[model samples]
Target: MEQNLPVACVDLFCGAGGLTHGLLKKGIQVKAGVDVDPACRFAYEANNGGAVFLDRDVESLTAEDLASYFPRGSYSLLAGCAPCQPFSTYAKGKDTTQDAKWKLLRSFGDLVRKVQPDLVTMENVPQLPKHAIFNEFLEAFDGYHTWFEVVECKDYGIPQRRRRLVFLASKLGAISLIPPTHEKHISVADVIRDLPEIKAGETYPNDPLHASASLTEINLKRIRQSNPGGSWQDWDEDLIAECHRRDSGKSFRSVYGRMRWEDVAPTMTTLCYGFGNGRFGHPEQDRAISLREAALFQTFPKTYQFIPKNERANFTVIGRLIGNAVPVRLGEVIAMSIADHLKMVNKAEKKAN
Candidate 1:
């Protein structure tokens, strides 16, 4: 197993490093990382191999810079996940392409085409059954042996009902994603039940990583009316916002909702902290889900500590990173799949020789 290990990996758009953490867990060396988001510097480095983080955007990654991150002359594996917000169908009517973020994947592909690593991988939201960008990407890789699959997170033992599209390609030899583990599903309670109770806006006394976000008084009232596994429809007519009474407003019922302890959480967005966004309320608690709970729902290990002695636990910062991250568990699946593929390639070459 030690002999099969790849020398190094460079994570582009590393974010807070749910992917980096997964890479490290499989004994893959993450040499250097890059991301535009400054919020990631502390936690990405804190948890994943203490890598050097370049705060530059992925578009700026040079072939030479990527070359330096790998071993002198060995198998080169390059991994990057471009920002996914623009392609998301949720913002369909909202002019997603108007934003500069949509061009990031093409920029990432530029680097991929230049560096031409032995292996490449990327993950993104399932751009609804629409969108030509995904098809364009496939045509771009016309000559390469590529495999793209829309993997449901539960099939790979993530427990959460997340559906993501993952792509893997190789020049070293034919490689495929790791077959799903599909052992058993982890429940909402399985991940967060052990955490100590913190009222809305309360932090854990002993472990700062366990700290929850505080609730404003109005937000607290909103949570009280929300039911676990229930939507804004549960709110009395008096509590309903004036717009909610209208047809257009009724469509927003998924907001200000509580999670079912027995079921998995809805996909966590970057703004999971807001009570009015997504089904994020805490079960049996009168507040939106805590930062720690959100992290757990994202499949971060309960014992996964972010800050050390010198740092203060800021929920706003951690929450954003955790919420925005590729779930560490999801990363593990990708990493292991890459490792397994490389192993198969090596064994095949040995047999042919």
Candidate 2:
């Protein structure tokens, strides 16, 4: 655990390398990131510099497969932020337990048991801890000291109000996430107000990812009428959707709203680039946020590359990568906490000796 001792990490379910980027920023040596999405290879390797990306599913990954990338005798950290859609509140009433994705957490736990890494960490939707698989994952940490909390990403300097369940376990000793870095939350204007403007369906000539989703005439009109921080209620009665006229639809108010400049943006979901999904409309623009803006809200750097120079940007593929990513800032906080935990344990051992 000493500063001189080597610490290496292998990120499982490493979509687009958000967590890996954060760990590397904090000086942790991340050897590789593993995931099934071939689309992520470019972004993951391109932005993370030296980290390798293994395009494979976690279910098929063996202890040996992971061991091949890690150094022998180095303190190893196994980190996985398994897909959260199965356990998300939005998926309620569906048979989540029967879903194939439900087994992913168990697979992650099994690998931890086999690899027996010095540390383990996971991030997921805040509702994840209520599921039985979560408890099963904790059981895998039998001898390790573990701590978990539903953390607000804004408190950690992320410019979005994303609430996530974060778990950290250490064989060395007790561990927790780093303390909040910002007493004042970062706002939407703080992150994306400076980007060049583009019309719906137009890509900035200089930045490929800055392209906005094309809006239909009706949608464009809707967006123009939408007020920042206001719900569907702010729309003209004639412009309101047919669904909103029903008694049942009155309760669903967050959709088709614009983000407020002074407030933190809502959680970015996989479809965040579309105005109809959540409150994704741009505060001043007449279109939904661009892909680049969505990634920025997820705390990815402005320069994080999601596509090759010659390749055209694909909204679905890139949006999923950005939305599913663990906010890079949150990942940094986790890495710093692990580093401090190791330092504390090392100091205690030196005193005891």
Candidate 3:
């Protein structure tokens, strides 16, 4: 709130601090992070330095609670990115009315109204705009200059090809996101090609950072059958399940797929290890992705610290955290754009005064 201090951010659903890390690089001071997973506490705090990471669900947030962190109008930012599962492609056609995640967006809007910060932003699947709750959010947030667009993570120089819808709102005036940073899209090889190779059930010998999930026999066979940038259609017809043969299964592609060494990776997901999940197999390796590979794709620093050890990197909860995180590089772009906007606002105010 002080003119001398930098703009501050309170990140909601801040998984592993990926967005916080990027915003920090752009000179935004992160006040704290909120999330439900206790597993993220260690890495989010350790890697993010001064920022406090809260392991609380967003639905439980209150004005009094948020006001305690931020005095009246002291908070320059009130950013909230509710989890995207309710509207994600994976949940397509599934009834989500009873789902608790549906309320997260409107609750975020409620927080924005209560906190009354100068700026706010949210990130989620593009399909979110189709939901009624999202429509209510837009209606409740009138008068703030707002823009929403589906952006590709690769366009912002992240080494993965992922798409997300981003929302930026500011009371100061209209604010738009930065355009793509890298004209030449970064490739998977550019990020992780140098990491040492490990077998199906192995970890790298020299680099403690190197890690992979152990594979079952069925998974190994599935990976061998998969082709980079290809789909389950590559599998032998015998390997196809009765479900695939059924009328409802024809549209589900991307299963047991691999990456292309020359291109950015497919979107990372919570079930990235499952052969049937998506195009998550290694580009050249004879296995599904390892923990180290997944983190690399998410653009997390190699030196980031998590509790326990790298051997446990592929555990369900840990893997989910890494795969679901905002790419640090993409986060940086958003941060820089916000910082630039802040500077412009300050300059205009000085001239007017």
Q: Which runs of model 2 end up more than 4 angstroms from their true locations?
A: 88-99
State the lDDT of candidate 2 residue by residue for 22-44, as single tens digits. Answer: 98898778999999989989999
Give TM per candidate: 0.90, 0.95, 0.89
Q: After superposition, how far is residue 140 of candidate 1 from its true place, in Å?
A: 5.2
| Pairs in clash, predicted candidate 3 | none
- Model 1 lDDT tens row, 1-353: 24354547888888888888877787778877799888788777877765778898787778887777887656666776777664434455454434455678777777777877777788887762255555555554645678878888877767577888888887766767887787667777777777777777666677676555666776677788888888878877777778889998988878888888888778877777667778878787776767767777777776666666546677667777877778888778887887777778788888999
Q: Point to the candidate with the largest TM-score.
A: 2
Instruction: Report the CA-based lDDT of candidate 1 relative to the real structure.
Output: 0.74
Write down the worst ten-residue block by lDDT for model 3.
86-95
TM for candidate 2 is 0.95
Better of 1 and 3 by TM-score: 1
**Better structure of 1 and 2 per TM-score:** 2
Q: List the candidates ranked by lDDT, beginning with the highest.
A: 2, 3, 1
What is candidate 3's lDDT per residue for 227-304, written digit by digit as tens? Answer: 888877787887776787888987888677888889998888887755567877788898767666787788888876
Whole-model lDDT, model 3: 0.76
| lDDT winner between candidates 1 and 2 | 2
